[model samples]
Target: MSGVDLGVFARCFPAQAPEPLGRAIADAGFSSVQLNLSAIGLPTIPDAQALADIDLVAVRRDLEAPGLRIWGLSGSYNLAHPDQERAREQTEDAARLIRRAPELGVVAVTLCTGSRNPDDMWRAHPDNDTAEAWADLLRNLGPLFDAAEEADVFLAVEPEPGNVISGTDAAVRLLDELGERASRIGFILDPANLVGETGPDEYETVLRDAFDRLGSRAICVHAKDVVTWDERIAGAAGLDFDLVRALHAALPHPVPVVVQDADPANLAAVRALVLGDA
Candidate 1:
């Protein structure tokens, strides 16, 4: 239906074991997933105990049993949390997952650059733009970057408006600051994040600019629509789906457009919307 591959967040499906989970995703007409361990009733970044319990071989077999590919793993943790101790613990867990990703034939792990807000990583805080927040982000990401390089995996950072790496410019700045470690970093482009108070007339321009700057560095893409600052949905009435399709087609290479924020009940509509068949 499209040149680009279509995927969905595994968390968008019901939580169950891997074998049945795979069948559910495949039965929903998707051949790809951005796997979140939580979808199968585990932490997003599993501990050694949980990790050891996983059967990598069976996981791969079952998820692919119905021809579903694991495009990437969800390794999100708060890199800039005000509580340094808690943040470090989370990073360590995520690093473990990043190091273990290759065993599942996955090469990328998605991350949130995170926020200064202690309770909510996704919520914005006045301090998020402070120098200290940036420093915390860099400090927290160091170990994960090391794990990624060691395992030959890419750390795909999503630029959320509410987070420290707030936009394309900030994302570019992070790469610059990483110096040698920048090679291990990449991006996950979600057009919704780039649109804030932007008028419909400027959606294409805004999206195009983002693509021009970050498209080369993108390892994944998220297809979702923004109805408000905090609300995201698939098949959103206000977002321009054709613009999403056109810009996706213009990408330098193919990347999976993972449908994020879709309700399980809206699976068919989200599929059609992302596939350009709506």
Candidate 2:
């Protein structure tokens, strides 16, 4: 964890406004944050008026005042929605967020590879593994890549259990297919997302393989202690800290390992575990 910077998702502090949330995170001992636009009342796809109304200078000042760094913005949306119109809308929103990321002092934007489930992007669907699904995903990604290139920002895609790009191999394949455009794309490596309720030995093997395959391309890490496929906590889900350290070591450069999907009451415990105090 020497080179890893610990952070939390801004949405974790739902009780506080954006600026106060930054202060709360810093006071809680985190050094960085991944912002959710909705936390600040900005629509997922903000128009020119909304964008103009955002006081980036004040936002930056407020966050920095408490020693908090803005690592990335969460622009996660379903790229493989069953509804073509909805997918297009989400993609356009992603593009808008990417274009405006720099002005907000964000280095990257997190995204979901998406599922065929029209209702929930994080839910699994049988069609997620089909060739047609892959094609649809690629087609949708093209415009986002164009937007990333134009904005000069990195797009971090997380490979979840039920998404079209579910595991390490699929993620690597998607990256390869993108080819030159892959430079603007990066991975948000979440160990918990790649494993479920399994034996410690099998979990270790799968997690290690994931780092071996995609660690080099990761721009950020998500720290969550997953017990079951759907049950995730803040920290210490029986995963060895040594493996976490090794994963961080494998990265080409230091990046934020942000904690997510945990309850507000568990944030302190999560922070302690991430900082090696537990």
Candidate 3:
């Protein structure tokens, strides 16, 4: 664990102000965080006036003052919206976020691969698997990748169960499509998101295979655990800690493991579990 960083999603402390949020995360024993820019009063797309008006340096100070490192910025948006105009807006916003990341001292900007459901980016729809949906994803991401390359920041793509790029194979295929631009893209491996109603006997095998497929490209890991398709929880979620440890060990480089989708009060316990101290 010498090289690995442990973090929590900054949104977990929704009720607190930026300074208090950072302090709370540090108090829970996390040294890093995946920050939502909005929480710090930074617009995802800062207009010329906003660029001048927003004091990002001060924002960084607020987080760092509490001993929390900003590992990445959450720039999640609907990249695969059925409406082309709406999707274009989302991509442009992402480009803006990408351009501002380096100044914030962030290593990557995490994103949703998106869904065909125009109303809900996380909800699954049949059209998500269609050629048109894939094309839309490619179309939106192409310019976004160019922006990432110019910004020199990595884009960490997360694979949720219900999105255009929902699985390890689809994610790898998208990376392959990007070719050289793929260098700017990384993976956020959330083992719970990868699990899909596998029986008790097959859970470990399923998880190990996913790690084998995606670990090398993973830059961050989400620390939520899943018991079944519908049952996700903090801590181990009934999965073996030994298996999780092994998977982390297999990564080519140590990356931040971020705790997500858990109650704020359980953060300390989650941190301990993720660090193998619980």
Highest lDDT model number:
1
10 residues in a row with least lDDT, candidate 3: 227-236
Better of 1 and 3 by lDDT: 1
Query: Could you estimate the TM-score for every candidate?
Result: 0.94, 0.91, 0.90
Taking the tens digit of each residue's C-alpha lDDT, what string does model 2 give over 17-135?
56687778888778998888776666655666676677766777776678888999877888888887888877876777687777778888778888899889999999999998899
lDDT of 2: 0.78
Q: Candidate 3's residue-wise lDDT over 1-278, tens digit each?
A: 44567888887776555788788888887889988866555665554566667666777788879778999988788888889898887687678767777777888988888898989999898999999999988888887888788878899998887899888789889888988888888998887777755666787877787788888888988887764312433322566656777788788888888888756666666666666776
How well does candidate 1 match the true structure in TM-score terms?
0.94
By TM-score, who's the top model here? 1
What is every candidate's alpha-carbon RMSD to the true fold? 2.3, 2.6, 2.8
Model 3 CA lDDT for position 64: 79
For candidate 1, write residues 16-42 as lDDT tens digits.
999999898888888788999899888
Model 3 backbone overlap count:
0
Clashing pairs in 3: none
